[model samples]
Target: MVFRPPFEEFEIQLVEVPAGETVPAPTNPGPLLLLVTRGAGSAAASGGAAASSKLLAQAELRRGSVAFVPAGTTIKYTASGAGDLQVWAAAVNAKVFAPATAEEAAAAAEPALVAA
Candidate 1:
């Protein structure tokens, strides 16, 4: 689904990871909020020059667990236990809500994925 706010646009995606599977880290140019819909898992995020991956957080992921990932951060997701992990992700454009100076607008339009 799609959500169009006055200042930003967000896309909702359903992500599923089978048990014992690890998904590669993904970097977003904006912020993202993930709500767990089923199962359990752990997320690891890292940013800045140090660049070392650390446990961002873990959740039982029943029905109300939510995870927030800041802009420009790299996050890796791993599914735990025998049940599949399902998450509803809402990704928002940071620039839309927090625009930079006029000169930076052009550059901010492009999205960059930082390596984890």
Candidate 2:
């Protein structure tokens, strides 16, 4: 579903992935914040310039799990476990927020998944 935010600089989407399904990797034009609200899954980022296939992060999704993906990063998501994966994702312009630290920058550079 489409989500119209109070501000025009961003948008949110409700995404669902069937159990045992995977979504192909795709690059986004802006930063994306994905919050898993149900079920379980993993989101991975494809190695970029080096062409390496490495997992950036993984989590057993449940309510409040969050994943931050920076702009232009290619990401692949898989839905596993016993039920379908449901997530609330928000895409925001990268220019809107500035990384405050090296760690934050590093985290934002790849797929940083965290369980809540």
Candidate 3:
């Protein structure tokens, strides 16, 4: 958002990937900002779509670690320890980026613009 609401784009989503569980995160709409806020975990990205995805890269994620997943990539997250793995996703032009109300535009613009 412009300091006064100009270019309102992108979304912020919080997700918790618990231990003993693996979840697929498909980021096809736009680039992703993966920030591990709490707990420890790991994420892996592949080369192809589901069922045939080849491992492209992997990362050991912990507190203060950040991952930049490109627009057309898929990443899997699994909590490593007892605590749940919490992630803050800031995706540009995806998720809750659509702002129908004037107020939403203001709130939405701040993060998107600042992130950019």
Give the per-residue lDDT digits (tens) of candidate 3, residues 1-116.
11212343756667788786887876545667789999898888764333253333777889898887766666788889788898887776542344468886787677655543
Best by TM-score: 3
Clashing pairs in 2: none
- Which residue pairs of candidate 3 clash? 1-109, 1-110
Better of 1 and 2 by lDDT: 2
| Candidate 1 structure quality by residue, lDDT tens digits, 1-116 | 34445555775656778888877555667777889888787766677311543445433455568977767776666788678877777887434656478778777676787678
Stretches of candidate 1 above 4 Å error?
1-8, 48-62, 93-116
Candidate 2: list runs displaced more than 4 Å.
Answer: 47-60, 93-116
Residue 102, model 1: lDDT of 77
> What RMSD does model 2 have?
12.8
lDDT of 3 at 15: 70
What local distance difference test score does each model get?
0.67, 0.70, 0.70
